[model samples]
Target: MSDLHDLFLTCPKGLDGLLLEEAQALGLTEARAQVSAIRGKGDLETAYRLCLWSRLANRVLLVLSRFPVSNAEDLYLGVNAVSWSDHLEADGSLAVEFSGKGSGIDNTHFGALKVKDAIVDNLRAEFGKRPTVDKVNPDIRVHLHLDRGQAVLSLDLSGHSLHQRGYRLQQGAAPLKENLAAAVLIRAGWPKIAAEGGALSDPMCGVGTFLIEAGLIAADVAPNLKRERWGFSNWLGHVPAIWKKLIEEAQQRAEVGLAKTPLWIRGYEADPRLIQPARNNIERSGLAEWVKIYQGELATFEPRPDKGQKGLIICNPPYGERLGDEASLLYLYQHLGERLRQSCLGWSAGVFTGAPELGKRMGIRSHKQYAFFNGALPCKLIMLDVEPRQFVTGERGERSDAAPAQGAAVIEQARLSEGGQMFANRLQKNVKALGKWARKEKIECYRVYDADMPEYALAVDLYRDWAHVQEYAAPKSIDPEKAQIRLLDALAALPQALGIPTERIVIKRRERQTGKKQYERQSAEGRFMEVEEGGVKLLVNLTDYLDTGLFLDHRPIRMRIQREAAGKRFLNLFCYTATATVHAAKGDARSTTSVDLSKTYLDWARRNLSLNGLSDKQRLVQSDVMEWLREDRGEYDLVFIDPPTFSNSKRMEGVFDVQRDHVELIDLAMARLAKGGVLYFSNNFRKFELDEGLAARYQVEEISAQTLDQDFARNSKIHRAWRISVR
Candidate 1:
């Protein structure tokens, strides 16, 4: 066994089986799979081949020794027993990485230190000189693993984690590692597809991981051919001739692969900022000629290939980490499914997502589902046979609605569904009913339709020229397939019935949010557009957040503030984006102060003020409204309080539940009001009950009717309002 080395190939979790197969195919003999690792016997050439071509492995480690140890002294003795002089120079630098902990080795840091000490001491004793510790770019990298009562020491043949292919130096926020991306492509049958000269595409290609990996596979290029350094580079037993021969073979293979492979690989990213970075990564990977990235959105995603060329669509769509982020992501997955069915009639799709529940919403039936872990988060790669016959109806029968068709034919069916026509008719009726009123009132941003037809549970609001559509989550009793068809109908009808362009129709899902009220920036594109309300310009970012900065239901409320704000100092509490303050300032308010707990909203408020030229008479403040009211020593003629129903922001001193604390909040506001001043209070909590004790304490009027404008007449319970004044 002198010519063979015991090797362990480690990979991302849940990839042990795949890694085992790849390793065996790469000439690793006696291969067996363990948890997140594969143990095998291989000659030096086999190790080099695994390091070069095995795409699923993270590290290839050659076992040096195995010993039974229960304490630090024994561990040191086991490591020191290896002849340090045989593998490395005494004056060379080395780094030790240790994993697992037990048997008196309580932590990994101390374990690594002990291993480093033993190696250095042994080398110094032999050569009268000590090796230096170089954690970064070390001459030699060693691994120590302690499991239960046994210890295995090894030399890392792959210098870095094999996932770091040196192509992607810049990436998106939640990037899929290169090795994991390769696993997804392999499981998606990309190698077979590419061998047939098929196409490949990723709709949401953040930094182009899938595209680049697929290109390498299609070209038969070694995954690590361009890597310059390895663990064996500085070792004493390193064979330069064999390594040089292997590298030359890889280069020749790459040259042939590059010259002959006519692959159509592309990626589409909505974020404009990432296109250059993705292009740069592709350039670095030497796949720029084979792979191209463009700035396009999921709604408009389409692969550009020659006619009759069907390929694979692979994407790792974002599955948000919290409820606040899910509202927007639900629509993204739906759009992906819709596009796959519409454009790619016979193409295959691989969707990798952590939230498997969201995968079911794609409507297409997956023939197979594979489980893998992105680091520690468990994920599923669902393989879809995207032909018309594979819709996920219980019978797996062909259906008119979900069948793959040409682009125009898909749109025709999308609009011709009985449910879709019904949805479209209701939208037309709503526009006729509300268009006259909206135009007469000069309301640029208003709701035109809010689920008037029970089958279509969507709210379509007009944001100037764009339609902001929100789909309310259907009841669990409703079939998701039926719901999806109806939603698509509604979306298809929106552009035509509402007289808006297809690209301007933005869709969202209305999910019941739970958890702290911490705002999450979901999209990398921080896009914002200005819309006019009450003749005042307000900024609304439609894609970056769930709520489009301005709340449409509060239009009448803000207009009333403007009408009554002449020559009066006003205070606006919880003034998100300060839309109301802008109107108040426009109406010639003598002075104004707007308070909120979020610095982000405050900065937005400042921008709103600046955009409206109202900063001269207003102050945008970042503070808890309760705390600000308690400390302020000012009187105002007009005061508006639109507090959130509940808040658990860490920026606030304590939790805020409006139902329990509204009275105290009102009392604090009243103390700062002038004798004849008016204080208007409001909240969106539907089940809220104003305390009976409030009427007896002061003059109060329920003005919920006045705030219910023509646009929100259908959903009158959207919010509650009140007018209170000192008695």
Candidate 2:
């Protein structure tokens, strides 16, 4: 009954060895690292000590049984044979959690269900009573893992994953995973540095993961110092006195170091959105009194004279992946390096990046490069030793030429810790599954969208025969460029999935605001054109929006209008490129009128019309569609009304949001329509709710069916297209 037991501690990736060291240092002997995990042999009290004190481990599990499991039946028997009552009470509630790789059983839920069944059935058959399953918080949490036909059942000693440090009351977009953040700090040698009075800094810290981790380590604060509950609380052989003594010891350790000058932990970002969460994280860590954060562009940032003098400057800059446009983030990276090099003399710098191209812009050679996993991105935490001269000259504005960029190299055999790879592989599998579905459904002309925010992490949409299926990788931080490259790689399969040739597919990247897009004065006319290629003409417009011309998601809608335009009088309202009008004119429309508020857009629309062989008779009007609809009396057989969600300083006489006044806009377009004319009304606002009353007033049918192009199959709301007529 008192035999030493083999147990495992699961930490976030890169912290397995560190956790092993921590456990061994705490007298849990025979510690070993196994893929984001640490294993050791001890009685149940060792598990209690880990739950109470271990910082890097996500969870500690008591190994119940290990057996060869070929299938679900094998899994059941292996789990059922374990003495469930030995740990969990007959009337107690238990939960089974499962995770595995290279096993016949792939579905984690089904695997968990099998394990649950085995436990319940065994207890019922043996003692005539079955334990209840509690998911929210189980009295006893069991873990069933299968790896290469081997099943290992264990009891979860940590009620929850260790990453829930209980300090973070708020978070920003793609906040670093707590365990990964800890691993990053440990890897950066924060514990050792802090012990030696070497300061820590996170210049681009969104939520102060680096700085907070550093502060906790420096203050001798246990990673779980603030956590309320651990699974060992319910274990049969728990040691309350020893746990209390250890906690008190940790508190006593924390009380010793009250540094007069605050620990040099500081974070800065241009956006207040990031700053808000950084403050919350720091405050929650109880380091608010010690840590300082500032809001300003990196270019304008002046490092405090006394701080970061001989400290570390760490930054996780925006990767063009989720935020969009790698080409634009270069200046930000360069600016950051310039600021650090100019101001932070004698500072050691750590730049963690998924985008190696941005690394070139830093203009400094790294002394060491630590390959680490920031989620799935095979990122490099490049360390640079800065000399005072480098700082002085960099401050003096020795700006270097922005180097020409190259594609990010594909990461091969990225070594991820156990759960890291598992989750990443599972995510990769799901993305691949979505990609496969896209191909099978003949999807094309669709957006792979993640509109939620921070513009990063993961989401993909496949456009197929008039339908869209969106696959998302809920919000999690990864390398921005890696995320984008993966998205593009998935996108490369889109045309094939939709049965459309790659030549016909158009890729439009949303641009981020930087010096490239910033113009002191708006050009009077937008200069863009229609280029003919591979049997179809492509219209590209640059001036009116962050994007150039093509709205690839509307490919099917535009084609449908073209197909229906022969012998019809066409009207394109809020037309930017007027590509649809040109397509209509190409289909022999009797006449066409293209209206938009932007004179720049109107000129681009005119060029599209001219490029498509349309004459002056197919008029391009530079006027607001809303105002034009009020005065225009001309009737048309085909009308296209696509308005922006909101615009203030536009050519439009007034602002417009399609969701707010779409009914009136539709009514106005219908007033200028012929008796049997068809009105194609559309908007890109995904949350737009169609007004049934407005549709009832007119003879309308949701022509979303016709507008569903092969490429736009993933989401029909890339734009909601409808057909209406006056009753």
Candidate 3:
């Protein structure tokens, strides 16, 4: 083996340029960038320097032999040609990582096995002993790449991928690989920003990846200074004196950089559990003095005034992986954009996300967007310069201004047009009329506005002092801009008429939903408020979900449940948040069983039940309602079945269409009914037609009219109810 050898420094795709630049800076000769790896010529010392200092590399590989091979026999001969004694002893352990396909070596595992056989056979012939294979923590790590009948064999100089900086002992879900994090920081211009004494902030930092990477960059600290092991630690070709000198020099540079670098770095995570891990990672990285992390929500995240006005705000907010994540993430992205526009003026902001459509919801134009991959998932890094022009104006022409006076501008701009005035007048009238009835009924939550005007197209509900607005999705025939203006007009008029702050008003677009769409989370804010209805305290989350915990139109139905629930065993089917179950429990029912397919809502029901001290004799079961009804043998005196109009949740064995499945669902519930039981079935399918056979089989009465309280009088078709009893 030659002392000077061809080398390759591999990195994640899209980071080849950065790795090449770092290799050149490290004085490697003839450096050239490949697809995801950089090729260079260097000696053992140069390789050691790259291993210790290169932040963008995943591994540093020293090429041993390159040859053309057509079959397994040829592959074995090519592998045996290398001098194994130069890198590994016969008694040492070794491992092989093979990749690519060609030349009759179609399977990676088979190719790796063949190469391992060649190495062992060569060593046995030369020294009558062969190295044993150790998959983990091996003394020698070898890599084989095959393409188009050519194989390139190399020795892995980094035991693990260089991305494992060894500082993070713990991390949250989907933590960014350290090399990828370094790439994001470099692309965000963190090094130049730090050179200019600028600061860095990550408002939604989960494990402080960005902050730690930024700290390392700002302080000129070697990326692997704390790493204790390497692939070549026991190699015969390794030079201990040269490696020691490099380590000492890196330590001296880090010491001076730590003292002289003036960089302000901070991270904020909403989850308290993530805070301690983030702190631990930062401390382990030896950047504790330069970085700070705090537990906080994004709504209150602001740039530190003392840290100056310019810096970088970079974050990799959760790229929702589950079914319900997109809806919830939309609001989070919107809030992030708003915060950037309001508090990060004169700074640069970069948002890395796998869901680019969610990024569009930010309402800010991006200056640049670079495509990269988070593992196999293609993602984008959106870079925005937070200038005045980047601030998006709302429908009322309210721009995000950093000054306090900007809020007054928003309120002042909230004026009503002639149509808007008429809409506002109608809302005021309904509030006055409903206000009286709500006070008399002791109801703190009720529908105050229900698309009173066609142009307005909104349902406004009052939850105590808070206003929850659900905008009806406008028709495709209407110009989107016009509909947006009308929405803006309605949003502005609500706060003025209701005497509430804009922050207290939560808005969601309500369209006809199918499947599990409606149950999807809209945000992870978890901001719940306690509201009283029928003298029961219920937890309501207006911003986190499409439907508030309690349905305003179902007030009379719950009241009826309370009236007839005394001394009876109550079963609430499709018990969303179990608000009716709470009413039944309050009504002194003998026992209550709430069944729903959603564990999230069941947990919410548990909390609501706990809030009212109604935990005894109450069971919250997570099961498919239809399946549960078929399997349940226990009898109940009063049963309430309020199911969705259509559901195709994977949790359910089959599809559920209320109009089609109503009779079957009723029969199943009726089978579990007691001798004098009454089954109340309800749904919101507007064109529902009751099965005439059900009426003949049992006593059936349409109580939908009675179920509509005064608050829901304007829309009696909101839900239909039927009372069934055995004849």
Q: On residues 1-727, what C-alpha lDDT tens digit does candidate 1 reach at each position?
A: 1399999999989999989889999989998999999999989998988998889999999999999998999999999999989888999999999999898988899999999999999999999999999988788899999999899999998999999999999999999989999999988999899888899999999999999999999998999999998988998878888888889999999999999856989899999999999999999999878999999989898786965688999999887764234435555666787888777777899999987766765667788999999888989999998766665443232344544344542432222445656777788888888889888988888898888888888888888888887789899999987786666556655666777766577776777654343245655568889888789999998776677889999898899999999999999998888889999999999999999888888899999999988789798888888988899999999999998877767778778889999999999999999989999999988889998899998999999989988988998899999999999
Q: C-alpha displacement of 582 in model 3, angstroms?
A: 7.2
As for candidate 3, its clashing pairs are: 328-522, 328-523
CA shift of 662, model 3, Å? 6.4
When summed lDDT is taken over every stretch of 10 residues in candidate 2, the lowest stretch is: 407-416
The number of clashing residue pairs in each candidate reads 0, 30, 2
Give the per-residue lDDT of model 3 (tens digit) for 1-727: 2367899889888889888888999968998998999998988889999999999999999999999999989999999999898888998899999988988889999999999999998888899999999999999999999999999999999999999999889999889999899998888888998898898999999989899989998998999999998999988888899999999999999999999845789899999999999999999999998999999999999978364557999999888764334334655776787787667767899999997766755656688998888888899999988765555555343445534455321211323555666777899999999999889989899998887688888899999998888888889998987786576556546667888876677878888999988989868888999998888999999888899888888888899999999999999999999999999999999999999999999999999999999999999999999999899999999999999988887788889998899899999999989999999988888888888999889999999899888878888789988889999
- Per-residue lDDT of candidate 2, residues 497-552 (tens digit): 34544333333344322322421222223544444421246565333344445566
> Model 1: which ten-residue window has the lowest total lDDT?
408-417
Task: Report lDDT (CA) for all predictions.
Answer: 0.85, 0.66, 0.87
Cα RMSDs, all models: 5.7, 16.9, 6.6
Which portions of model 3 miss their true places by more than 4 Å? Answer: 1-3, 294-309, 322-344, 355-365, 394-443, 447-462, 465-530, 534-553, 558-680, 683-690, 698-719, 723-727
Q: Candidate 1 or 2, higher lDDT?
A: 1
